[model samples]
Target: MKKQLATALAALVMAPAMSATSVDLGYKAYTSDTKSDNGGAYDQPFVKLTHFNKADWGTLLAYVKLENPGEVKDAQHGKDGKLTVKSLLIVDKQIGDTSYNFWGQNFLVSNRTVMEDNLYLGVTTNRKYGALFINAGVGLNYSAAHFDPTGASFDGISGYAAVINARYPFSAMGLKHSLSVNYEGQIDRDEDHMSTLGYDSYGHQIITTLKTSMTESFYTKLHMTHFDSWGAAPNDGIEYGVAVGFTF
Candidate 1:
Protein backbone atom coordinates (compact mmCIF):
# COMPACT_ATOMS: atom_id res chain seq x y z
CA MET A 1 0.00 0.00 0.00
CA LYS A 2 2.80 2.39 0.81
CA LYS A 3 4.52 1.60 -2.47
CA GLN A 4 1.32 2.19 -4.39
CA LEU A 5 0.83 5.47 -2.62
CA ALA A 6 4.35 6.52 -3.37
CA THR A 7 3.90 5.71 -7.03
CA ALA A 8 0.65 7.61 -7.09
CA LEU A 9 2.29 10.64 -5.58
CA ALA A 10 5.11 10.54 -8.11
CA ALA A 11 2.60 10.29 -10.91
CA LEU A 12 0.93 13.44 -9.68
CA VAL A 13 4.18 15.38 -9.86
CA MET A 14 4.85 14.07 -13.34
CA ALA A 15 1.48 14.78 -14.88
CA PRO A 16 2.71 17.50 -17.22
CA ALA A 17 5.18 15.08 -18.75
CA MET A 18 3.20 12.08 -19.98
CA SER A 19 0.26 13.83 -21.60
CA ALA A 20 0.74 12.34 -25.06
CA THR A 21 -2.94 11.63 -25.58
CA SER A 22 -4.66 14.48 -23.79
CA VAL A 23 -4.89 18.24 -24.10
CA ASP A 24 -3.06 20.23 -21.42
CA LEU A 25 -3.10 23.88 -20.45
CA GLY A 26 -1.26 26.10 -17.97
CA TYR A 27 -0.32 29.76 -17.32
CA LYS A 28 2.61 31.71 -15.90
CA ALA A 29 3.13 34.79 -13.71
CA TYR A 30 6.61 36.42 -14.06
CA THR A 31 7.62 36.58 -17.70
CA SER A 32 9.45 39.66 -18.99
CA ASP A 33 7.38 39.67 -22.16
CA THR A 34 3.98 39.07 -20.62
CA LYS A 35 1.82 41.61 -22.40
CA SER A 36 0.07 43.96 -20.01
CA ASP A 37 -1.56 45.93 -22.82
CA ASN A 38 -3.46 42.92 -24.13
CA GLY A 39 -5.68 42.26 -21.13
CA GLY A 40 -6.00 42.30 -17.37
CA ALA A 41 -4.97 38.66 -17.19
CA TYR A 42 -1.52 38.09 -15.73
CA ASP A 43 -1.47 34.49 -16.71
CA GLN A 44 -0.25 33.48 -20.17
CA PRO A 45 -1.79 30.12 -20.89
CA PHE A 46 0.37 26.99 -21.32
CA VAL A 47 -1.65 24.93 -23.71
CA LYS A 48 -0.52 21.94 -25.83
CA LEU A 49 -1.45 18.51 -27.13
CA THR A 50 0.42 15.18 -27.39
CA HIS A 51 -0.16 12.28 -29.72
CA PHE A 52 2.25 9.44 -30.44
CA ASN A 53 2.24 6.00 -31.90
CA LYS A 54 4.10 2.83 -30.94
CA ALA A 55 6.98 3.79 -33.22
CA ASP A 56 7.78 6.90 -31.18
CA TRP A 57 7.03 5.62 -27.69
CA GLY A 58 10.39 4.64 -26.21
CA THR A 59 12.83 7.07 -27.74
CA LEU A 60 13.43 10.49 -26.25
CA LEU A 61 12.09 12.83 -28.94
CA ALA A 62 12.25 16.59 -28.49
CA TYR A 63 10.71 19.42 -30.50
CA VAL A 64 12.27 22.05 -32.72
CA LYS A 65 9.47 24.39 -31.76
CA LEU A 66 8.65 27.54 -33.74
CA GLU A 67 6.23 30.38 -33.05
CA ASN A 68 4.70 33.23 -35.06
CA PRO A 69 2.84 35.31 -32.49
CA GLY A 70 0.42 37.62 -34.36
CA GLU A 71 0.15 35.26 -37.31
CA VAL A 72 -1.50 32.52 -35.25
CA LYS A 73 -3.11 32.04 -31.86
CA ASP A 74 -1.22 28.71 -31.45
CA ALA A 75 -2.39 25.42 -32.87
CA GLN A 76 -0.48 22.23 -33.88
CA HIS A 77 -1.91 19.01 -35.19
CA GLY A 78 -0.32 15.80 -36.37
CA LYS A 79 -1.40 12.19 -36.76
CA ASP A 80 2.01 10.50 -36.75
CA GLY A 81 5.57 11.45 -37.65
CA LYS A 82 3.95 13.64 -40.28
CA LEU A 83 2.44 16.84 -38.95
CA THR A 84 -0.97 17.88 -40.15
CA VAL A 85 0.22 21.52 -39.79
CA LYS A 86 1.27 23.93 -37.07
CA SER A 87 2.35 27.46 -36.37
CA LEU A 88 4.54 26.44 -33.45
CA LEU A 89 7.41 27.41 -35.75
CA ILE A 90 6.19 30.94 -35.25
CA VAL A 91 6.00 30.45 -31.51
CA ASP A 92 9.40 28.79 -31.26
CA LYS A 93 10.93 31.58 -33.30
CA GLN A 94 9.13 34.30 -31.37
CA ILE A 95 10.16 33.05 -27.93
CA GLY A 96 13.71 34.23 -28.63
CA ASP A 97 16.90 32.48 -29.66
CA THR A 98 20.61 32.72 -28.75
CA SER A 99 22.07 29.40 -29.74
CA TYR A 100 23.46 27.97 -32.97
CA ASN A 101 21.94 24.79 -34.40
CA PHE A 102 24.07 21.64 -34.19
CA TRP A 103 25.95 19.98 -37.01
CA GLY A 104 24.85 16.39 -36.23
CA GLN A 105 21.70 16.01 -34.14
CA ASN A 106 18.78 18.00 -32.82
CA PHE A 107 16.87 17.24 -29.65
CA LEU A 108 14.88 20.36 -28.84
CA VAL A 109 15.10 23.16 -31.39
CA SER A 110 13.70 26.72 -31.60
CA ASN A 111 15.34 29.24 -33.94
CA ARG A 112 13.00 32.11 -34.81
CA THR A 113 14.89 34.60 -36.99
CA VAL A 114 18.30 33.28 -37.90
CA MET A 115 17.94 33.37 -41.68
CA GLU A 116 14.25 33.94 -42.39
CA ASP A 117 11.89 31.91 -44.62
CA ASN A 118 14.23 28.97 -44.15
CA LEU A 119 14.08 26.51 -41.24
CA TYR A 120 17.24 24.63 -40.21
CA LEU A 121 17.82 20.90 -40.21
CA GLY A 122 19.51 18.75 -37.54
CA VAL A 123 20.42 15.18 -36.51
CA THR A 124 21.09 13.48 -33.15
CA THR A 125 22.35 10.18 -31.77
CA ASN A 126 22.62 8.74 -28.27
CA ARG A 127 25.35 6.83 -26.53
CA LYS A 128 24.80 3.20 -25.79
CA TYR A 129 24.12 3.85 -22.11
CA GLY A 130 21.67 6.65 -22.98
CA ALA A 131 23.73 8.73 -20.60
CA LEU A 132 25.08 10.96 -23.40
CA PHE A 133 23.50 12.39 -26.55
CA ILE A 134 25.29 14.61 -29.05
CA ASN A 135 23.38 16.90 -31.40
CA ALA A 136 24.42 19.29 -34.18
CA GLY A 137 22.81 21.22 -37.02
CA VAL A 138 22.88 24.29 -39.21
CA GLY A 139 20.25 27.05 -39.40
CA LEU A 140 19.70 29.61 -42.15
CA ASN A 141 16.75 31.83 -41.42
CA TYR A 142 14.55 32.72 -44.36
CA SER A 143 14.69 36.31 -43.13
CA ALA A 144 17.21 38.23 -41.10
CA ALA A 145 16.06 38.86 -37.53
CA HIS A 146 16.12 42.25 -35.89
CA PHE A 147 15.01 41.55 -32.35
CA ASP A 148 12.72 44.21 -30.90
CA PRO A 149 13.09 46.13 -34.14
CA THR A 150 10.25 48.66 -34.49
CA GLY A 151 9.31 47.60 -30.93
CA ALA A 152 7.44 44.77 -32.64
CA SER A 153 10.25 42.43 -31.54
CA PHE A 154 10.94 39.89 -34.21
CA ASP A 155 13.22 37.46 -32.39
CA GLY A 156 15.53 35.44 -34.59
CA ILE A 157 18.68 33.36 -34.00
CA SER A 158 20.43 30.09 -34.83
CA GLY A 159 22.43 28.00 -32.41
CA TYR A 160 22.95 24.49 -31.07
CA ALA A 161 22.13 23.11 -27.63
CA ALA A 162 23.80 19.93 -26.37
CA VAL A 163 22.56 18.06 -23.33
CA ILE A 164 24.45 15.38 -21.44
CA ASN A 165 22.42 13.53 -18.86
CA ALA A 166 22.83 10.70 -16.38
CA ARG A 167 20.25 8.93 -14.26
CA TYR A 168 20.44 6.23 -11.59
CA PRO A 169 17.67 4.42 -9.76
CA PHE A 170 17.25 5.66 -6.21
CA SER A 171 16.60 2.46 -4.35
CA ALA A 172 15.49 4.24 -1.18
CA MET A 173 12.44 5.76 -2.91
CA GLY A 174 12.20 3.58 -6.01
CA LEU A 175 12.94 6.58 -8.19
CA LYS A 176 15.32 7.69 -10.86
CA HIS A 177 17.17 10.93 -10.31
CA SER A 178 18.59 12.59 -13.42
CA LEU A 179 21.09 15.42 -13.81
CA SER A 180 22.01 17.12 -17.09
CA VAL A 181 23.91 20.02 -18.62
CA ASN A 182 22.59 21.67 -21.80
CA TYR A 183 25.12 23.76 -23.69
CA GLU A 184 24.60 25.78 -26.87
CA GLY A 185 26.48 28.02 -29.30
CA GLN A 186 26.39 29.88 -32.60
CA ILE A 187 28.47 29.07 -35.67
CA ASP A 188 31.20 31.64 -35.83
CA ARG A 189 31.50 33.06 -39.37
CA ASP A 190 34.92 34.66 -39.52
CA GLU A 191 38.50 33.76 -40.35
CA ASP A 192 39.34 34.15 -36.67
CA HIS A 193 36.30 32.05 -35.80
CA MET A 194 37.13 29.41 -38.41
CA SER A 195 39.11 27.48 -35.82
CA THR A 196 35.93 27.52 -33.76
CA LEU A 197 33.34 27.60 -36.54
CA GLY A 198 31.61 24.71 -34.88
CA TYR A 199 31.90 26.58 -31.59
CA ASP A 200 31.54 30.04 -29.92
CA SER A 201 28.29 31.84 -29.06
CA TYR A 202 26.58 34.85 -27.51
CA GLY A 203 26.00 33.16 -24.21
CA HIS A 204 22.60 32.88 -22.44
CA GLN A 205 22.70 29.67 -20.49
CA ILE A 206 21.26 28.04 -17.32
CA ILE A 207 20.61 24.83 -15.39
CA THR A 208 17.27 23.03 -15.63
CA THR A 209 15.57 19.87 -14.30
CA LEU A 210 12.65 17.65 -13.16
CA LYS A 211 13.25 16.15 -9.76
CA THR A 212 12.00 15.38 -6.24
CA SER A 213 10.06 12.17 -6.59
CA MET A 214 8.31 10.64 -3.60
CA THR A 215 6.05 8.50 -5.72
CA GLU A 216 6.51 6.44 -8.87
CA SER A 217 3.72 8.43 -10.46
CA PHE A 218 4.20 11.80 -8.83
CA TYR A 219 7.10 14.27 -8.66
CA THR A 220 7.95 17.92 -8.65
CA LYS A 221 9.27 19.11 -12.00
CA LEU A 222 11.31 22.30 -12.19
CA HIS A 223 12.42 24.05 -15.38
CA MET A 224 14.62 27.10 -15.98
CA THR A 225 16.68 28.03 -19.06
CA HIS A 226 18.68 31.13 -19.89
CA PHE A 227 21.15 32.28 -22.54
CA ASP A 228 23.18 35.44 -23.24
CA SER A 229 23.77 37.73 -26.21
CA TRP A 230 26.03 40.75 -26.87
CA GLY A 231 23.47 43.46 -26.11
CA ALA A 232 20.74 41.32 -24.58
CA ALA A 233 21.19 40.58 -20.89
CA PRO A 234 20.68 36.89 -20.26
CA ASN A 235 17.02 36.09 -19.47
CA ASP A 236 15.79 33.24 -17.37
CA GLY A 237 12.53 31.88 -15.91
CA ILE A 238 11.26 28.96 -13.89
CA GLU A 239 8.32 26.62 -14.37
CA TYR A 240 6.92 24.39 -11.65
CA GLY A 241 4.51 21.45 -11.71
CA VAL A 242 3.12 18.85 -9.29
CA ALA A 243 1.16 16.01 -10.84
CA VAL A 244 0.82 12.27 -11.40
CA GLY A 245 2.58 10.59 -14.32
CA PHE A 246 4.52 7.54 -15.50
CA THR A 247 6.93 6.31 -18.20
CA PHE A 248 4.80 3.47 -19.51
Candidate 2:
Protein backbone atom coordinates (compact mmCIF):
# COMPACT_ATOMS: atom_id res chain seq x y z
CA MET A 1 0.00 0.00 0.00
CA LYS A 2 2.78 2.38 0.85
CA LYS A 3 4.55 1.72 -2.39
CA GLN A 4 1.38 2.18 -4.36
CA LEU A 5 0.72 5.47 -2.62
CA ALA A 6 4.24 6.64 -3.27
CA THR A 7 3.87 5.86 -6.93
CA ALA A 8 0.64 7.77 -7.08
CA LEU A 9 2.27 10.76 -5.41
CA ALA A 10 5.16 10.63 -7.85
CA ALA A 11 2.69 10.65 -10.68
CA LEU A 12 0.93 13.64 -9.20
CA VAL A 13 4.20 15.51 -8.84
CA MET A 14 5.15 14.73 -12.38
CA ALA A 15 1.84 15.57 -13.94
CA PRO A 16 2.33 19.28 -13.40
CA ALA A 17 5.79 19.14 -14.89
CA MET A 18 4.34 18.03 -18.18
CA SER A 19 2.23 21.19 -18.33
CA ALA A 20 2.61 24.83 -17.46
CA THR A 21 2.98 25.08 -13.70
CA SER A 22 3.79 27.89 -11.31
CA VAL A 23 6.31 27.01 -8.65
CA ASP A 24 7.52 28.62 -5.47
CA LEU A 25 10.63 27.82 -3.47
CA GLY A 26 11.52 29.26 -0.10
CA TYR A 27 12.63 28.66 3.45
CA LYS A 28 10.46 28.91 6.57
CA ALA A 29 11.24 28.98 10.25
CA TYR A 30 8.31 27.85 12.32
CA THR A 31 7.77 26.68 15.87
CA SER A 32 5.38 23.81 16.38
CA ASP A 33 4.05 22.57 19.71
CA THR A 34 2.56 19.44 18.25
CA LYS A 35 4.46 16.46 19.63
CA SER A 36 4.22 12.86 20.71
CA ASP A 37 5.84 10.78 23.40
CA ASN A 38 8.94 10.43 21.29
CA GLY A 39 8.81 13.61 19.25
CA GLY A 40 9.42 16.77 21.20
CA ALA A 41 8.66 20.35 20.29
CA TYR A 42 9.96 21.45 16.91
CA ASP A 43 11.64 24.85 16.69
CA GLN A 44 13.67 24.55 13.57
CA PRO A 45 13.85 25.81 10.03
CA PHE A 46 12.51 24.06 6.97
CA VAL A 47 12.46 24.40 3.21
CA LYS A 48 9.18 24.60 1.37
CA LEU A 49 8.35 23.93 -2.24
CA THR A 50 4.95 24.51 -3.74
CA HIS A 51 3.45 23.91 -7.15
CA PHE A 52 0.19 25.00 -8.74
CA ASN A 53 -1.33 24.16 -12.06
CA LYS A 54 -4.63 25.13 -13.59
CA ALA A 55 -5.94 23.61 -16.77
CA ASP A 56 -9.16 23.05 -18.60
CA TRP A 57 -9.88 19.90 -16.66
CA GLY A 58 -9.11 21.08 -13.15
CA THR A 59 -6.51 22.51 -10.82
CA LEU A 60 -3.72 20.97 -8.80
CA LEU A 61 -1.94 22.36 -5.76
CA ALA A 62 0.91 20.57 -4.05
CA TYR A 63 3.58 21.32 -1.52
CA VAL A 64 6.54 19.58 0.05
CA LYS A 65 8.27 20.50 3.28
CA LEU A 66 11.67 19.40 4.48
CA GLU A 67 11.36 19.80 8.24
CA ASN A 68 14.20 20.22 10.71
CA PRO A 69 16.80 20.55 8.01
CA GLY A 70 19.81 20.14 10.22
CA GLU A 71 18.70 19.17 13.69
CA VAL A 72 20.16 17.03 16.38
CA LYS A 73 19.17 13.39 16.48
CA ASP A 74 15.75 12.79 18.05
CA ALA A 75 13.72 9.77 18.94
CA GLN A 76 10.83 10.62 16.71
CA HIS A 77 12.17 11.95 13.44
CA GLY A 78 15.77 10.77 13.61
CA LYS A 79 18.76 12.85 12.48
CA ASP A 80 17.23 15.14 9.87
CA GLY A 81 13.62 15.31 11.00
CA LYS A 82 11.16 14.31 8.32
CA LEU A 83 9.53 15.20 5.06
CA THR A 84 5.85 16.03 4.60
CA VAL A 85 3.96 16.20 1.35
CA LYS A 86 0.41 17.28 0.64
CA SER A 87 -1.52 17.71 -2.55
CA LEU A 88 -5.04 18.49 -3.65
CA LEU A 89 -6.47 18.08 -7.10
CA ILE A 90 -9.84 19.57 -7.86
CA VAL A 91 -11.79 18.66 -10.98
CA ASP A 92 -13.84 21.74 -11.58
CA LYS A 93 -15.94 20.72 -14.54
CA GLN A 94 -19.42 22.05 -13.96
CA ILE A 95 -21.90 19.33 -13.23
CA GLY A 96 -25.29 20.77 -14.11
CA ASP A 97 -24.55 24.00 -12.33
CA THR A 98 -27.50 25.30 -10.35
CA SER A 99 -26.06 28.54 -9.01
CA TYR A 100 -24.43 26.53 -6.20
CA ASN A 101 -21.55 25.85 -8.62
CA PHE A 102 -21.18 22.16 -8.03
CA TRP A 103 -17.69 21.26 -9.14
CA GLY A 104 -16.42 17.76 -9.72
CA GLN A 105 -14.14 15.58 -7.66
CA ASN A 106 -11.65 16.48 -4.98
CA PHE A 107 -8.66 14.26 -4.35
CA LEU A 108 -6.53 14.95 -1.31
CA VAL A 109 -3.42 13.23 -0.10
CA SER A 110 -1.35 13.98 2.99
CA ASN A 111 1.74 12.07 3.96
CA ARG A 112 3.88 12.95 6.96
CA THR A 113 7.18 11.57 8.21
CA VAL A 114 6.42 8.16 6.77
CA MET A 115 4.38 7.56 9.90
CA GLU A 116 0.95 8.70 8.84
CA ASP A 117 -0.76 8.89 5.47
CA ASN A 118 -4.25 9.92 4.53
CA LEU A 119 -6.29 9.85 1.33
CA TYR A 120 -9.61 11.52 0.69
CA LEU A 121 -12.02 11.60 -2.21
CA GLY A 122 -15.26 13.53 -2.64
CA VAL A 123 -16.96 16.52 -4.19
CA THR A 124 -16.08 20.17 -3.91
CA THR A 125 -17.70 23.54 -4.47
CA ASN A 126 -16.42 27.04 -4.96
CA ARG A 127 -18.14 30.30 -4.19
CA LYS A 128 -17.21 33.93 -4.15
CA TYR A 129 -18.69 36.70 -2.06
CA GLY A 130 -17.27 40.00 -3.25
CA ALA A 131 -13.59 39.78 -2.36
CA LEU A 132 -13.82 36.53 -0.44
CA PHE A 133 -13.17 33.26 -2.24
CA ILE A 134 -14.35 30.10 -0.55
CA ASN A 135 -13.67 26.47 -1.45
CA ALA A 136 -15.19 23.63 0.47
CA GLY A 137 -15.23 19.85 0.27
CA VAL A 138 -16.55 16.82 2.11
CA GLY A 139 -15.11 13.38 1.64
CA LEU A 140 -14.43 9.92 2.92
CA ASN A 141 -11.07 9.42 4.54
CA TYR A 142 -8.70 6.48 4.80
CA SER A 143 -5.69 6.68 7.02
CA ALA A 144 -2.74 4.50 7.96
CA ALA A 145 -0.43 5.20 10.82
CA HIS A 146 2.36 3.53 12.69
CA PHE A 147 3.62 5.13 15.88
CA ASP A 148 6.90 3.54 16.77
CA PRO A 149 7.09 4.87 20.30
CA THR A 150 4.06 3.02 21.58
CA GLY A 151 4.04 0.32 18.92
CA ALA A 152 0.50 1.35 18.08
CA SER A 153 -0.72 1.22 14.52
CA PHE A 154 -3.85 1.83 12.46
CA ASP A 155 -4.58 0.93 8.85
CA GLY A 156 -8.12 1.15 7.68
CA ILE A 157 -10.99 3.45 6.86
CA SER A 158 -10.75 6.19 9.45
CA GLY A 159 -13.77 8.43 8.94
CA TYR A 160 -15.22 11.39 7.09
CA ALA A 161 -13.25 14.54 6.44
CA ALA A 162 -14.19 18.06 5.48
CA VAL A 163 -12.20 21.11 4.50
CA ILE A 164 -12.93 24.77 4.02
CA ASN A 165 -10.52 27.34 2.67
CA ALA A 166 -11.28 31.01 2.36
CA ARG A 167 -9.17 33.88 1.19
CA TYR A 168 -9.67 37.62 0.92
CA PRO A 169 -7.22 39.70 -1.00
CA PHE A 170 -6.94 43.42 -0.66
CA SER A 171 -4.50 46.26 -1.11
CA ALA A 172 -3.37 48.30 1.89
CA MET A 173 -0.51 50.66 2.54
CA GLY A 174 0.69 50.38 -1.05
CA LEU A 175 1.09 46.64 -0.60
CA LYS A 176 -0.89 43.63 -1.69
CA HIS A 177 -2.19 41.66 1.25
CA SER A 178 -4.35 38.60 1.75
CA LEU A 179 -6.04 36.99 4.69
CA SER A 180 -6.83 33.31 4.57
CA VAL A 181 -8.56 30.92 6.90
CA ASN A 182 -8.35 27.16 6.47
CA TYR A 183 -10.17 24.51 8.45
CA GLU A 184 -9.95 20.74 8.32
CA GLY A 185 -11.86 18.24 10.39
CA GLN A 186 -12.01 14.51 10.73
CA ILE A 187 -15.26 13.23 12.20
CA ASP A 188 -16.84 9.91 13.02
CA ARG A 189 -13.48 8.28 13.30
CA ASP A 190 -13.13 4.73 14.47
CA GLU A 191 -12.85 5.21 18.20
CA ASP A 192 -11.06 1.95 18.89
CA HIS A 193 -8.45 2.57 16.26
CA MET A 194 -7.99 6.21 17.18
CA SER A 195 -7.77 5.53 20.92
CA THR A 196 -4.96 3.07 20.42
CA LEU A 197 -3.08 5.69 18.50
CA GLY A 198 -3.66 8.36 21.14
CA TYR A 199 -6.28 10.22 19.15
CA ASP A 200 -9.81 11.32 19.90
CA SER A 201 -12.89 10.32 17.98
CA TYR A 202 -12.70 13.61 16.13
CA GLY A 203 -9.86 15.97 15.25
CA HIS A 204 -9.78 19.53 14.00
CA GLN A 205 -7.14 21.95 12.76
CA ILE A 206 -7.65 25.59 11.95
CA ILE A 207 -5.13 27.98 10.49
CA THR A 208 -5.36 31.68 9.88
CA THR A 209 -2.77 33.53 7.87
CA LEU A 210 -2.08 37.11 6.97
CA LYS A 211 0.24 37.62 4.03
CA THR A 212 1.71 40.78 2.61
CA SER A 213 3.75 41.13 -0.52
CA MET A 214 6.93 43.12 -0.16
CA THR A 215 7.43 43.00 -3.89
CA GLU A 216 6.07 41.10 -6.84
CA SER A 217 8.16 38.04 -6.07
CA PHE A 218 8.73 38.34 -2.34
CA TYR A 219 6.25 38.11 0.50
CA THR A 220 5.89 37.63 4.24
CA LYS A 221 3.27 35.68 6.09
CA LEU A 222 2.10 35.52 9.67
CA HIS A 223 0.34 32.31 10.63
CA MET A 224 -1.50 31.07 13.66
CA THR A 225 -2.82 27.54 13.95
CA HIS A 226 -5.18 25.99 16.45
CA PHE A 227 -5.17 22.29 17.09
CA ASP A 228 -7.96 20.43 18.84
CA SER A 229 -7.84 16.73 19.52
CA TRP A 230 -5.35 16.47 16.71
CA GLY A 231 -1.79 15.35 16.15
CA ALA A 232 -0.24 13.38 19.01
CA ALA A 233 -1.33 13.42 22.61
CA PRO A 234 -1.75 16.70 24.48
CA ASN A 235 -2.45 18.23 21.13
CA ASP A 236 -4.67 21.16 22.06
CA GLY A 237 -2.65 24.34 21.62
CA ILE A 238 -1.91 27.31 19.42
CA GLU A 239 1.19 27.45 17.24
CA TYR A 240 2.32 30.62 15.58
CA GLY A 241 5.06 31.45 13.07
CA VAL A 242 6.28 33.91 10.49
CA ALA A 243 7.51 33.04 7.03
CA VAL A 244 9.19 34.96 4.21
CA GLY A 245 9.30 33.49 0.76
CA PHE A 246 9.79 34.18 -2.88
CA THR A 247 7.49 33.20 -5.68
CA PHE A 248 8.32 32.41 -9.26
Top candidate by lDDT: 2
> Any residue pairs clashing in model 2, and if so which?
none
| Candidate 2 global lDDT | 0.64
Tell me the tens digit of each residue's lDDT in model 2 across 32-151.
445442243444455566666654335556665654444432334554454444444445443454323334333332224326666776677778999999988888877777666576
Regions of candidate 1 where Cα sits further than 4 Å from its true position? 1-118, 130-172, 189-201, 212-219, 230-248
TM-score per prediction, in order, is 0.40, 0.74
> Model 2 off-target regions past 4 Å?
1-39, 72-114, 232-234
Relative to the unseen true structure, what is the C-alpha lDDT of residue 21 in candidate 1, on a scale of 0 to 100?
38
Cα lDDT tens digits, model 1, 184-233, are 44443232221211113433344454455555544444444443331112
Query: Using alpha carbons, what is the TM-score of model 2?
Result: 0.74
